[model samples]
Target chain A: MPDWQELVRQRLSGLALDPSEKEEVHVELAAHLEESYEALLKENVPEQAAVSAALFQVTDWQDLQRRICAAKKRGHIMKKRLHQLWIPGFLTMGLSIVFLVTLQKLGFNARIVSWRDSDIFFYAPWLVSLPFLGALGAYISSRAGGSRGTALLASIFPALALTLTFLLMFPIDMIIEPIIGRQADFKIVAAALLKDGIGWMLFPGVALLAGGLLAHVLLSLRPSSRETAIG
Target chain B: MIGSGIKRGTAELAVLSVLHDGPLHGYELARRIEQQTNGALRFTLAALYPMLYRMEQQRWIRGTWETSANGRRRRCYRLTPAGKKKLTPLQREWAELFHALQRLTKVSHA
Candidate 1:
């Protein structure tokens, strides 16, 4: 019988492949031959005959290529779907936290407190925190593969942020100018938020924003890997 | 003569079936296919590696690096669990097609 390796080399010499990939094929094909040889041996074939018989059972390269392509295409589609869902929720919450924390750090004590019918400072940070909730909702919807959903989410987040800010500011007006009974002192509200610890409320909003942006980048870049795979 | 398009797929099924038993390097795999076909089917190395690489991507098979008898390092492949599952349906389909083709030709009354 021909040297098995020589026989293999002669057969495969036609298909040109990258060196590393070629090596991979070589090992796999060898294992295939060994198993077939064993089976032939069991059938009482002579040693030479069994080895040669095992070689006869092999398939061609073109057929294997088609199967691999189909499989890769399927894997690509699955990964794309996953990218669509994961981007939005992660970003919205991240941004929200950052916004809140940053505001707090700036010593902006924008909160409203009434003592038996009296206004206090404007707690702007607390009000701003409310808008981020809507933003989070929009982000989540957007990432879930709905263009309309993402647009709706993107549009509503700003509205929620603004509405919360507006609603909270109402008490600020009450503090500045007494509408009814004794008005709250706006200075006290400002002082309270600026009191070192209260400044940290901005941390959450900033943190949320950072996380949101990170998710967005990851999703956007998801397709880039295809280039390398194709290469 | 088999159509070029169908021939490739048929060859892959045949090759995968052989590998289903175990791993084999490139040259061995090609020779075995030719031997099995009784000289009907010939496998060329030029086409083998690319197909093997593609199969590796599909997760139907996995390749591991090993040294050959000649002390040359090469990567070898074996059927994965996923590949094992795929073989049954593929084999069924192949048999169905083969029988259908034979019936169309009306060669024998076996």
Candidate 2:
């Protein structure tokens, strides 16, 4: 007898079927063999002829992949949009609320730093971290629910955070600077960021590294079929 | 056999007709069509599942998970009421198209 299970697996190897899907294909192929055998016997064809005839009827895996890809491509735009608009926006809003509430609880003097010094501390690290955080957020969301959720969260959160932060900066500067009006000695900040330059890129460079790692993690977490095809 | 669009259409129709009988997994569906055609028609997986899924989206068929006699689970497809209704019209159109093709081919041969 033909090893129908093995035959089916071999046929399905090139196709991007997850374990469950592979098992499904196996059962279907085995059932097909039974039907093929019965028909061949009725026709008085030899067993080998029947098996060969049956094997010839199996569908081509490559064609199925192409079709599935085409279908996904057609429908994925809407999925991408939902991701871009909804999930990340929520994350950003949630983060902003937390930041605002925490800052409000802190006394005014606690935040009353020289405008030049505080602004540099507040904006500079953020300038580096926001994109880094955005990349991290994107990476997480990409794999969030097998890629779609990640893409949605990643796109929206960064945009939302950047917009809100920039808008808040003008008002925040006006409020803080009148009292202290101090500026950071740039040389000190530059030295702090550049100390590890040989080992890492300066401020922006470190952020970029975080973003790249985030992308890797995000890309790694996609569903098996897509990952397998890509690999 | 090699990129013939009309032949591909017939193959799809034949596959749909098999599904009309009941839900069969992909392999069984392919085998049934070949047997019915007496080994004349062959379906590739590329062609079969896409058509099946398309028909599914169109509400012409429905699929469900079923455990087979072999103690393995498979996704099987069956014709819906809508599919049955659509099938008649499609079958009629196919017949007309085939007839037209045959007549044209005959004239060319003559």
Candidate 3:
């Protein structure tokens, strides 16, 4: 009676569903709410109270949206997973790697400057766009109902991958160097590689994490009732 | 008041038992359940609808949009063959649970 359809449609604005399917849901739910509201009114409840009571029948619209999506898109969930989770994840990682590779191709070398009695790798050039890219990825992941851990992981995948590379591949590289007749000092080479790994892990990683944190701040309104309450 | 955890366990059975009689829209189904249970099994719209959608998706129930006698459109849900088949086992399970609780706590079901 009170434009329940419009009210429902507004409440469920970001439901990731097709128009027709969503419209069907909207109509069905609106009708149910209207009926309940009318019934409450028949019981001599005030109009505003009846409206509130009917609205309170669905305390968590976001959960309803997700459950409906899960039920309706059971088969399509894998595709949706690819859309919501993997797409953003890969885009962030891909962009980070591409930018780093581009810097290498462009002959941009990192300078090691001593700071606070420790040699530090200065790579401010390639790190310029990383925060923005990371933020975009995190924002997309958040919009897709990803939690802080998943969103952080998606945004910082580049740094994590580099960390893994350093942890695993560096050891293998160290082992293979001797067989290749490169008589580099093991202690010195290990130290340098460790420093390099820490550098890559620290600066770019922090920038990306900063981006993820930024997304969290900017997306303060992001967590639906489902996310905060259920989770 | 029943805990939500317990209510969730019987939600499907409650819905199926109600629909066993005949087709009803979402609102009618919810109201009938609350009334029949003497308001002990009140279901929120958030709880009822997603389960309804899931049941429909599983081919246990079918929903058809129809015009009511009052000329208002309603989506009425009727039990499918699958739904009818499922009800017996669910009823048996609830019966077994009640019997077990009775044996344990000397509490009889109404």
Candidate 4:
């Protein structure tokens, strides 16, 4: 008839488990102790002896607390990673598709191999959006406990997807033939692909870097007011 | 009574073997483990719950809260296919270890 729940809560107070998880552990332990106490009582054990026997179960409460907290922390990290990285990464990919379709509607051809001024203008919007997309990714990653490297990697996902798609769809010969026709040799086509690929990627890559660095800097600069106060 | 070290080492297999019978709540699982082991192996809430949570996380066992006839809600743990798959290998390993120990010590089977 001891307040087993309160006892459990007090024992678990130092653990880093969130409120709900702590409550769950509290309830489960209380239930277990209650059962143990009842079983002892059924055998005509004295109340004090039953309580002592029940309490004896957890020989090392400190070790138990550490283990439970560590397990919960790992689970939290996995869930946070999925939410932070993949969700935004996929959303960005969806938005990129919409942006590409809009560009096509505006009479901007995506398949042009030439580095004409018009071609540059056509690709400019996609390139311009990359920094913002990267910023979004980095911001989310930072919020989810990701390091600067993780943020940078997350920011680069959309660009990586685009690059992979282009390479998969059009080989150098196929790409160059459409732009320069038969006048372009394999070497010229290869050179153009390399040059244009880098050209298209350069701004976006910088944007990703800038966004990741900016997120990291901003996060590091901000005071961890809550943790500080708690500590 | 078995040493805590030995008890803890076999805790997972013990729980899995008991749960192979059917789903049981934490209290029932602990009670059955003690009863079946003839009080040699006993699990405290501190020791058992963490292992249960770890096994649940590993997808070996699944826990679900169910209301008893008395309207008390308790989390019951059941063996998953994954847990069942693990039991045979674990049993074999323990058997091998016991045989080796018996051979080395010249001890008869208890």
What is the C-alpha lDDT profile of model 3 across A1-231, one tens digit per residue? 589999999988777877898999999999999999999999999999999999998888888888888888774566556655688878998988788788989999878878778887877777777888788777777777677776777788788776666566556767877798785465465557667664667788888889987886777655552363111
Ranking by TM-score: 4, 3, 2, 1
Best by TM-score: 4
Kindly report which residue stretches of model 2 are placed more than 4 angstroms away from their true locations once superposed: A58-140, A145-153, A156-231, B1-4, B10-47, B53-60, B69-74, B79-110
lDDT string, candidate 2, A1-231, tens digits: 777778766765654544665565455555656666667878998988888776665455555555654543443445554554356545644553454355546632122125433322222433344454446455545443435444434534534344445455555656665656764344343454344332223333344335634565556566653452131
**Clashing residue pairs for model 4:** none
Model 2 lDDT tens row, B59-82: 777778787677756678888899
First chain of candidate 3, TM-score: 0.54
Q: For candidate 2 chain A, which ten residues in a row score worst on lDDT?
A: A108-117
What TM-score should be assigned to candidate 4? Answer: 0.71
Docking class for candidate 2: incorrect
Candidate 3 structure quality by residue, lDDT tens digits, B1-110: 88888899889999999999999999999989999999989888888898998898878899999998898889999999999999999999999998898787864443
Instruction: Please report the interface RMSD of model 3 to 1 decimal.
Output: 1.1
lDDT of 1 by residue, B9-103 (tens): 88778778989888976666777777887866676543565566667677787867788687666566788998898889999999999899889
Using DockQ, give the best candidate's number. 3
Which whole-number lDDT from 0 to 100 does residue A176 have in model 3? 72
lDDT of each: 0.57, 0.58, 0.82, 0.75
Q: Considering lDDT, which of the candidate structures 2 and 4 is the better prediction for this target?
A: 4
